[model samples]
Target chain A: MSNTKLVLVYKGFERFWHWTQAFLIIFLAVTGFEIHSSFSLFGFETAVNLHNKAAWALIILIIFAIFWHITSGEWKQYLPTTKNLKAQIEFYLTGIFRNTPHPTKKTVLSKLNPLQRLVYLGLKILVIPVMVMSGLAYMFYRYPQAGIIKSANMEDLEVIAIIHTFGAFVLVAFVIVHLYLITTGHTITSNLNAMITGWEELEEDENEPSVNDEPVFVTEPKI
Target chain B: MQNFKPILTFLFAVIAPLVIITLALREPETDHELLNQLREKYTHQHKLGIDHSKLAILQQDFTNPHAITAACLSCHTERGQEVLKNAHWNWEREAFIPGRGVTYLGKKNLINNFCTGIASNEGTCNRCHTGYGWQDETFDFTNEYNIDCLICHDNTNTYEKQKGAAGYPVMGADSPDFRNIVGHVGRPGRYNCGYCHFHSAGGNNVKHGDLEMALLTADRTIDVHMGVDGLDMSCVECHPAENHQMLGRYYGVSSSNTQRATCEQCHGSVPHTNSKLNEHVVKVDCRTCHIPTYAKVNPTKTYWDWSTATKRQDGKPYELVDSVGNVSYASIKGNFHWQKMAKPEYYWFNGTADHHLISDKIDLNNLPMKINTMFGDYHDKQSKIVPMKVHRGKQPYDTENLTIIQPKLWDKEANQGALWIDLDWEKALEKGMEYLDMPYSGKHGFIETEMYLPISHMVSTSDQALSCVDCHTRNESRLANLTDFYMPGRDQNSTLDTIGKWLILLSLAGVLLHGIVRVFISRKNKIAETHK
Candidate 1:
């Protein structure tokens, strides 16, 4: 039908990180909804224990993923670009449904589209961090200090709970959109297959560009 | 796979501290030696004032309680007379209740729900009486030696006046049980006072929900002031004795004493460091917050429906234990509802209480009578929110006379009319009224009644006090029944709440509509471009 070849796009660690992170997030959401008394699948106590354990596991995975990204120089993939960001939003809003050509290309150096980078960056910096910090605060709220087990003052607890719940809602919305986006690749199952097998089918024209074709702008020296 | 090395290291780095902290923060073993040392220190500090070796009168072989009192009076002459004037010894006091004028009320006069009254059954009831041998109405009250000093002053734990003994200690083969208690008389301990107070209404820890025999060895978590692990204070610390007259006074029962012990006496007006909490002291009693719940260790009787009492099919009285193993139904006492760790009912109470006297007429419209009513309100400047155990019951009353009837529960001679022996209510009432010289209408009915007992003891530590949400919540609040004034979180204005909710919904809808329009316009533009 078309000249297509399998390209080694996603690395081994990247695929592992993606699947593990997805499983963890899904598990967290299920347990979290149970803890919130939303159609309890597991009882409240069991859900709480599972949620806490999953949270700690996710935190550990996140920490290791951060180290791996920094070491492998793969952190550059998340750096957002302004060019074609408006076009990428337009593509999602109207063009994709109408069979219009995609605004951005996926290569080894640029796995995420411009709008994806912005959204993913926001999740990493704002929503995820907020959830993690608020969750930790809740977990250790009743930790003992100065011969007294100090609990969060009753007045302030409602605010913390609201912030945590709001973050969870944002994450849930992101996950729904992310699942839909997985089907928007070259084929319906192309993105999912790539994430599982570490290989993707790309158009010949969508190959990496030459260094001399575009001026590379370095932002800051690597840590 | 090479990434696993650094990843594992990172995971180890993060988890090590958490594990270590969790392990290190485990509660340490309690230091029993330190507790023993503290106990020894407390005992040494609170030694009695009297030297037993120097007091020759105390060493004498006493045959009767009166002889021992005579010996005690040999040195302390005014003590006997002073004690004689006390309501404990006299068993009657001039109570000047508001609106009722002055009336003599005490154990002698008041018809209590428990055991009814002391009238006509003085022998069995007078076992708790401070004076000796109060067998009948003709018993001498003016005798100075009749005062049982050993009942209040004995610390040997051996001085106990058994019921049916007429205010005398249990006797051995020939002499009073003087084994190991020859010279141990001192200021009263919790055991001495609890012997009577704790054992009121038939059994220990039965009458007052706040007081129990468990208090003798309670920990700080149970009771902060009286706990062995905390202050270990005796009853006298709060109810200080001066010239043989205790400072504490029962609200409705006793009105003779002007000096009543209050929380402010020790903690001062403002006890809390937080000024906002201290401000609440004006309208909230200290015990309301400090004592969140009552009967922490033992279950207390909350409801007693005496109307349920009847003979069993086997021609004997039946008894039924509840699911929790508490005596729920007894033929003698009737049906009881016991509650453990009970949240107290709150009310605005000043220092005064008005009791329903036996002579007072009850309005037929007021169906269930309030046996004792605590007086206060939100507008009263002297009033504060106080915690109380409102003991509810159904007791026999004169339906025609419109007064609560007293039944002779216990009789020394086992009279056929005695309620405890014969289990006949009519006969017991007839005999009890005849003995008191009061007219009975012969017609009787059981009426619901409530007795208000102000909760004072079993004070928990500050951390265990009620959280704000306990009372300031929309539903199931402790003060849900209290309708004095509006509380913020508990009450909501329906109009304002609806308006606020509608505004939020409108804002959400506006954002959604705006997004929908933008998407639609962008889609139309793209379609037009493609068509061109």
Candidate 2:
């Protein structure tokens, strides 16, 4: 084995945010399914209370994550591009099976490949937003103090519940696919190790452009 | 194939919602023509078979209700005798109430949270009474001609009864001319029955939450049976009278006869087309699904605090109407809380109800005595979940004797110690007890009481029945209080659920393990190739 220099890929706050968000999501999904009467883990009333708390925690985590992404100029990692998209799809479908090289190279600045960008973009912009909005609508459906916005119609609530459930299934599907993809890295444990220690070994040729050499856009303008 | 997959996914995503919306928006096919033909046939069949013009006895100008009844008895000799035997005419019937043994209880003998009792106030209360001149205890119950036939059989809708007149139709100012008012005496319409039933306890739509004045010309949404656009059914359609004995029984009062009007009589035991919903019939009453709410048009009195009855310094009764225009405060009655479009409280009831009879001593320690308690539970075979309007009130009761006191609410004489006349509790209690010959402890205090009134009318359409999720959900279920039997969607098992979750997690781990093994094998092969 050749000597390799360890590099810090994930920032301290980013790791903290990611782990906290993951914990909250897992807690939410567990409590949420219990609230749906899928199981009797925490009893009904306790499940509902825990689910609501987890939901709020997730929302706060998402807010902090959003601020962090914008401030650190890391939001660009989820920008979708058509270039190498077909190749990336082919790599996942057939090339991965044949043990062929990845069509697109991953970098610190452009960590996500084309397909990853699209999927992550959809999650952030579409699925997550839809889940958040619908969840909030369900939570505050009734306003006792407000005379006008007193309660939602029962039929409308049924529709909201359907949409929320649909979003939940989508998220569950994404998580399942994500767990499978983590093993598709250079080595079986490479991706898992990178995420934990925030250091990853890069190919000699792929290491030409340092992460620091990337174009610096002002994340926060001076007042 | 790869390109085709996304295209198919996109197409399916676009078309699925469209198909769902189209199916949702599709109008349900109905045979309006057939419905119209059936309605026509029903209307023809329902036409009054009696021709009053042919009967020369009906053409006579009758001055009083008894005179009219006597004229009618000449042809229908047995009708008066049958009518005289009814509980409505006698105002007393023998019935066994649970907790209280077999006793003579009726509107006359039973004390209600509203109006207290009819013992001393028989003259005023007898306005709704079927027979005439029940002013005192000596009023003959055996008199056949005393029955006011027009109260139940009037078709002209001109029948009117005034308070303090002892069941006589109003004379002079409020009276309709008997000459023009005489018409074909047919089966009672909504107005005929509603005249006394709907307008009970004082004004129209005041007493019963289910029976409202709006039912006279209500739409299909208000009451499925009585609605003008629907069945347009009169009271006697369901409550058919055999020998002047009505088939229906009041909620609080126990019926003497076993014959009572039930939805199953017409709809059968299993009414719903869906077998699953039909299964619920054994446990749930028809009204629980049909009548989602009661008093749709007008509010009904739910809470009455009689302790608030205060008289003015001028010796006149003071009254206060709430913002909703309900009589909140009245010196004669007291503070009342009314509610509109009220959702009924659910209970398990097996036809019979146990009432706290006037003669029975109340357990004062169990404050807020249940004046009438509905009997049943989820486990009982005879019991079905029924909806009811739980009317709450604080009425005067004998503190020492621990019995509800009957106050003389009204009297014709000016200084007869009526509660409404002088607002004196002691004097009214003494007079009221003297009429019943029951001892009152002389010391009276207002005690909270509850009366359960079963809701049977104002049934909405089938589509308006509570949605499945309303009860099958985790929380806020209508049947949340009913926990004797396990409901599938609302309940879960800890052990089974845990095992199921573990199985799913184990399957996922197994898949991950398989993938890791494959990756490991491929890497080992690559390492061997590199060494070669």
Top candidate when judged by TM-score against the true structure? 2
DockQ of 2: 0.04
In Å, residue A204's CA in model 1 sits off its true spot by 49
RMSD of each: 11.0, 15.8
TM-score for chain A in each prediction: 0.85, 0.86
Each model's TM-score, in the order given?
0.64, 0.65
Please provide, for model 1 over B147-222, each residue's C-alpha lDDT reduced to its tens digit, 9 standing for 90 to 100: 8888887777777786787787766564455533547777789988888887777776677888899999999888
Instruction: Point out where model 1 deviates above 4 Å.
Output: A1-223, B1-44, B171-175, B178-182, B252-258, B310-313, B510-532
DockQ of each: 0.04, 0.04
- Among all candidates shown, the one with the greatest DockQ: 2
Which residue pairs show backbone clashes in model 2?
Answer: none
Candidate 2 structure quality by residue, lDDT tens digits, B458-518: 9898789876556667677777877775553465555445554565576478557757766
Candidate 2 clash total? 0
TM-score values for chain B across all models = 0.86, 0.85
Give the share of true interchain contacts found in each model.
0.00, 0.07
